[model samples]
Target chain A: MKLFKDAGHLFRLAGVFLLGTLSFLAIRAFVVPHSFGQYGHYRGAAIAEIAAHPVHFAGHQTCETCHSDIAQTKSAGKHAQVNCEACHGPLAKHADDPSIDPGKPDVAVLCVRCHSASAARPKDFPQVDADQHSGGIPCTTCHQPHNPVIAAGGAK
Target chain B: MPGVEGFMYPNEISLYWSVLIVLYPFITGLVAGAFILASLERVFRVEAVRPTYRLALLTALAFLLVAPLPLQLHLGHPERSLEMYMTPHRTSAMAMFGFVYLWYLMAVLTVEIWLDYRADIVALSNSTTGWRRWLYRILTLGSQNVSERALHIDERVGWLITLIGIPSAFLLHGYVGFIFGSIKANPWWSSPLMPVVFIFSAMVSGIAAVMLLYMVLMRLRRQPIDMSCVDTIAQYLLYIFIIDFSLEMLDLIHRIYEADESFRSLDFMVHTRLWLSQVVLQICIGTLTPILLLFLVQVTKLSVPVRKRIYVVSGSLALIGIFAMRWNVVIGGQLFSKSFLGYTTYKMALATREGLLVSIALTILPLVILWVLVKLLPPWPEKRHAPLPAALAAD
Candidate 1:
């Protein structure tokens, strides 16, 4: 009682602070999503949302099913390890309908995305200075993207 | 890849943090530093700085109120930021920001300021009329007791709060440094010395800010500037600036001596891309020039007018230097590729969401808030009509 009389203002201030904190916590409880912490850190529902999106690039096997002749030639050549979609953009629509050709990518632009000279890339990787090596011609005019054997007739 | 000069990871092409991110720490550092300066009088009993104490607190509050706006604006889902408080990931340093910010705002700054101004607020509530009266009454929080005993308790509690506030101030800015420093993936930002350097630099910027505000406000009010107060603040600024510079040099030397793989790349960046903001603006002109000017004032006997001019120039330069430091840290850290083989440019946009125009507005918003706060609080001792309790008034 004596303490309350002497320090009533302090008590009032403490009460106000407590009320503010409680209100903040109550609001937080009301608004926070229920499944937020179910996963490692982020919202678990986010993973499901992402998984529900349609797959864009069909696997290499799907391409081989249609273009077996090109696939066989690619498998026998130096460019065997590279995926079809590495140079070409996603071809889900092309694979869905055979009439859709998905047409050839711009050879210089597509090739340089990976084959451009960079010190950070692996030393043995087939890199080229797009300006010097190609001499303004498209890469496909010299070396086939699918089967690159310079001595052999390119792209059959 | 088109704009890129060398080698950058596909994901590294676009910068995640923008100019507003730079302003976030800069503003928060000012708030922490200003509050720490105010605490010097309250906790450490530095009587010479008492005149600027309330003003410093008001400055801190005004800046603190605006500090989170940048982060909010930068967020993709600003509404979702509340999850940081409700469902914060325990392992993440970013998650702790919400808690640290709340603690500093409510537990330290607001409580300290409310206690310090309680008597004046209660008195104004009684003396004023209409909406102004209601405003003061709300500010008083219904605790209108200004009796000697009650006022004495307020003083004691306010002192204790200041004591707690010193560490809180350190934590607030140091934590910001840790946010950048802890990212081991970025060699430029990864340093244990980052937080210590941030704390000292924060002190330097904060002290300079309050000092300038004191001088300017005094001039505007037609009151003679307090020489002793300005002198003390300048002295503190000089000491802290020296420490900040030393820590930064230490980090530089350590990186140079080690000469790790990242060193060559970072060294090249510092020379080529970051030369202007980092070396010339931040180090040479902004830092060394101000330090030299402040050092001269300390050593030599200059005229009052000359000393005042020097303080203004150095304080302004110190602010520029600190802002440049933040820019170099946040923006420069992003310019170099993670592979350390190439560099990219920050093409600052004109009117976009996180662009140059928005950054300038964010920077000025704090001062406008300070102006409003000054009018409302009237931090000057003479501005308040309600007399201090007889005991404190005697002091």
Candidate 2:
């Protein structure tokens, strides 16, 4: 007691810190999510929550049912590996309602996104200068929509 | 989409870290640097630099308080930052910063200040009147003992805290460097010497800042500027700056020597995208100009007025240079694509949450806080009236 005789200030400061730390721990316990750090350092429920969300994008199988002729043309062409909805936006809503018209994608803009001339893409990936090649004409005017290699009259 | 050049990845088009991220390291660097300057007088017993000792500590606290605001504003969900303290990711450098900040703020800086000022608080509580009396009374923490033994204990404990603080200051900014340095994925930020360079730069900026503040504050109060103190501080600033510049050059030379796959892309970025900020402003105006000015004063037998002007110009340039360094590190690192194929641009939005206006406001907020703190607890050595507000000064 003699050592701490005039240390009432230090005692008071310690008391303040003790109360503060305890209060902080209590508040932290209250706020921290129960599911947090369950699997790792994140809320475990997030993975399942994201998974439970409804799936979009009707498969190429779904598109084949409605337009078998286009599917057959796409299968034989240079775009054999590509999917029906790859160029088109998500068609889950249109797939649900058959009457819902998924409007045609604008080939002037759409075709260039992948086919734009760039050093990044592989050498033989069939890229083009959309500005000089088409010159404002829609891509469908020069080539078939499904089989782009075969020209509009079915000649290569 | 508009700012894209070369071959940026689809996801790398829009930058995640903005100008706010630039301020985060810059502000924290000031805190680290200021604390180191204060610790020099306390821990090292550098008698000549005694004038700015308390001012440097107060400056550290003022800037340390504002340091987290930039990070919070940058976060998408600002509220979730607290969760870092609750369950910190053991490996995450950013997450661990919360604990480092809390330790430096609450455990180190605040405790050291209270202990250092306990005697003054108790004495002022008795002498002062009204809310000021109550304010000092609360600061005294119930015990009014300014006894010799009590004061001795405060000094001894404060010394110990300052000893702890020297390394803690290093950890504070060095860890900030580690935050960028440890990002092994980005070649620009992945240097092993980032922490050392950051520490030295922090010291340079922090020293320059206090030197400027001391000169300006003295002029405002119509007091004679302490020439010897400024001279000593300027000497240290110059030396530390040399080390910092050398370390940075070393990193650059090493990068050039070992030209990795990403070097060509980074080289192009430095030439084109980063030329203005990195090459012109940061290098020429910010770093070298100030170094040359300080060097002139150091070597030459200049008049007091001339030396003071040189100090002001050099200090201002040092701060600008450090800020530009932080800008280049945060914004520049993100400008180039990770694939070594492309580059993008950071278009600073106007009048938004993370914008130039908010950043300017955030930069000024610490100075406003320093003003209030100076009024509350006078850091000056001489027995003069505190710079109270007009209404309070009348009392």
Candidate 2 structure quality by residue, lDDT tens digits, B174-274: 99999899999999999889999899999999999999999999999999999999999999999999899989989999999999998999999999999
Docking class of 1: acceptable
Best by lDDT: 2
lDDT of 2 at B98: 93
Candidate 1 lDDT over A29-142, as tens digits, reads 787766777876767788999999998998789999989998988898887998898877799888998798888889768878888987668899889898999789877776
What pairs collide in candidate 2?
none
TM-score, per-candidate, Cα-based: 0.85, 0.85
Model 1 over residues B172-264: C-alpha lDDT tens digits? 999999999999999999999999888888888888999999999999999999899998889888988999999999999999999998999
lDDT tens readout by residue for model 2, A20-106 = 999999988898878988898888889999999997898888888988988888888888788889888889888889899999898
Worst 10 residues of 1 chain A by lDDT: A147-156
**Candidate 2 CAPRI grade:** acceptable
Separate DockQ for every predicted complex: 0.38, 0.48
Please give the fraction of native interface contacts (Cα pairs under 8 Å between A and B) kept by each candidate. 0.55, 0.77
Give, for candidate 2 chain B, the lowest lDDT window spanning 10 residues. B384-393
CA error at residue B265 for candidate 1, angstroms? 4.1
